[model samples]
Target chain A: MKIVAIDRQGKEHTLEGRDGWTVMEILRDGGLDIAAECGGACACATCHVYVNDGWFEKLPAPSESEIDMLDMALAVEPNSRLSCQIVCSETTDGIKVTVAPE
Target chain B: MTAAAPIETDVAIIGAGPIGLFAVFELGLLDLKCHLVDILDRPGGQCTELYPEKPIYDIPGLPIVTGQELTNRLLEQVKPFNPQFHFNEMATGLEKLADGRWKLSTDAGTTLIVPVVVIAGGAGSFVPKRPPIPGIEVFENAGDGVGVHYAVRKMENFRGKNILIAGGGDSALDWTINLAPLAKSLTLVHHRDGFRAAQHSVNQMRELEAAGKIKFHVASVKALHGEAGKLASVTLAGADKSEWHHETDAFLPFFGLTIKLGPIAEFGIHLNENLIPVDTAKFESQTLGIFAIGDINTYPGKLKLILSGFHEAALMSQAAFHIVRPNEKLRFQYTTSSSSLQKKLGVS
Candidate 1:
């Protein structure tokens, strides 16, 4: 699957994501500077990003715990999501997200 | 010191984790003064608190070592430096002072001014997990009133007050045992009979309960009764039919520990994701006079292993010396080969 991550400076990163790897892993492997702290535990909000508008509704709703951590994320938006929660798949190809500021 | 006055040092390290501890040795060898601030009340971060008894296999030459033992060795290794520590505090505010030095403050209101700042926080600061109940903060926001409390900032504040503590963790059980004699009345409430705290603490809590020194209830906080920001009464809903109102002046909930980037998230330094992005050469952040190491930082081909952080700390110190002592020429020497380095360690 392919995904795009736009950094704070507007640098676009196109990444090849393996099926089992998360969007965070793909972004990190592409050297796009995603924290992914606590790895994929979903405990930390450092992996926060804003999903593109039309794609936001296509994804599953954020879990309660993820929502709780998202509340602590900086510059949270309605489309905000944790990249750790977004595992890569064929359905998620072409997913576009903007990395949230720390 | 209060917020108005700042503590002066050559370096201010943001964490007291393992990597942060090692940085003290590197910076100390360069004759730079250092002060470390951490959210944990003690050193060793996760190693000491989370898995003190767990055996770690990957710490270099040691065949195997307990987490606490490893932490102890590191602390002993850095003892000669006489590094000062400010525990139970999070680095909150960061800025560049007028004279090109950095000014940083903690959640405890302690301020630090230094030419170089090192961030070694592992996954940022540890934040306590709060109960999911709504309106709990309203009482917590009441400013040390009856309804809610998270941190026991001042033990004296609860003296002679009726206190209710809820949780099955170590903190809840320990506080129940500690405050039973001091409080006018103390109650330990949990959702179930089983607890995850130390067996001794659980036994002591039970002993106090049996002796009538403290009350124990197997129930959950269903609702709160308080007005004007003060907690008055708490309703406990038991598994049985009875829902009872327990009168209390203060409520302390100790759910567990969770990590958050905390105030570090607000610093003006550009973050690659939630991490401090640093140059591989010096591990310095994009901001001048500030360097980041350990798991809290990210760079190209970065590895988060503890040994990698140790490597980053060494490089960070050489760069830090340039900022702390601009006029002095750096003399790089190995502890294994240099008598000066061995003498600094008191190890020859």
Candidate 2:
């Protein structure tokens, strides 16, 4: 799948991912500065991001732990999602997410 | 060749938490002596104090274990050398003696002389800040603070219990989502209807509420009600001065910790709030012979993680060892040499 990650500096990177890979893993492997403090256990909300419009429905719902983590995140929005909670799938092949201002 | 017995050991560690415990293991393997000290009655720092009952899934080599259990395993892992330990005494300050040895003062009025000091305090030493609301102190006397908590590690504590959560941040929202399933009833209160959490988390909370799993309150907690020294209900007031009461078994507030620069600040250590500025390569603070590890130290691209802290501790300890013993041979040895010595004594 093709995913585009826009950082806080507005620099965009188009990365490739396998089906079922979380956005967090893709960014981390790409050496982006997304802080996944809890290592994607959904225990800490350090990997939050804003998904582009119309992409929210394509992603799966977050777990309870992910919600708890996001509660402590900064600059949260309607489209905020823990990147670790967003799984890549056929319908989400061209997902666009921007790292939130931490 | 026999090792020379110097006037002092290599490093002195403050705070025997996970990071400190790991420092001992790393330093011991490097054939250095570490004197570990803590103000707590026992070791393990925050893991033993705050979340001892909470299960930790992150640490390697153990699929899952309680915080207290992890502390025990860490203690066991570093038990062979019998590293010097001092407990129940807080480190008050550090003084540079005329002889070049560092003098550390404790709250108990004891002074310790060491060459180097490593601070590995996790989010343990700092306390969570209580929300500043008018008449909030009234709840403190009625044991409302007892049921109201800041950190959520064990779901059992809130399981089958009616819970009310406050805040729109990630921590507050995360707990609301996690506890919705286990709690008999869950109520989430945020200052604004819009959340500052992950979009997916907010979506999940909305889904749970729609499915009759939880309730949301877009207001701030105004007052806490109690009778006979236990929480009875919480009163929330909206922006329009409307108030509502909801009976709850417990109140879980996920507001983040209010961190301040502690004792290290007195020594002229340069810092921004609780974070210490450092050279990413050396991990050295503004003061010589002093190093800050874990979340306390900040750099250009530093990501605070337990694993990253482990790496920081390893790097800092090696540099500390070198500072104390400039000419000493630096070797990479996995197992501590003391273990072999103990095996020879049949103590293993």
Candidate 1 lDDT for residue A47: 80
lDDT string, candidate 2, B1-348, tens digits: 232232355677777877788788777766668877677778876566545767877767677888789889888878764678778666667878787778776666556677788777553244444554444455443332246776775777677788888888767778888878888889988756777677999899999889988988777776677765477787887756688888987877665543233566676677765677777666788888877777778888887656677788878877887877778877654443656645632467
Clashing pairs in 1: B146-B249, B147-B231
Best by lDDT: 1
Residue B321 in model 2: lDDT: 77
lDDT string for model 2 (A34-88, tens) is 8665456664566789999689777777666566566665445567899988888
Q: Write the per-residue lDDT of candidate 1 for residues A2-101, one digit (tens) a residue.
A: 8988997899888887897888888877888776655666655668899995889988888866765553354345688999998888889899999976
What local lDDT score does residue A20 receive in model 1, on the 0 to 100 scale?
70
| Tens-digit per-residue lDDT, B1-348, candidate 1 | 457578999999999888999999899999888999999988988677556776777778987987688889999989999999999888989998789998899878999999999999888777776665667777876765356887787777788999999877678888888888889999888756767667899899989988999998877777788887788988887757378999999988876566778888888988976899999999999999889999989998998787899999999999999988999999999889999889889988
Off by over 4 Å in 2: A1-20, A27-33, A72-78, B1-10, B14-17, B25-68, B79-97, B103-113, B119-165, B168-188, B191-216, B219-253, B256-288, B291-340, B343-348
In angstroms, the error of model 1 at B11 is 1.2
The model with the greatest DockQ is 2
Interface RMSD of each: 10.1, 6.8
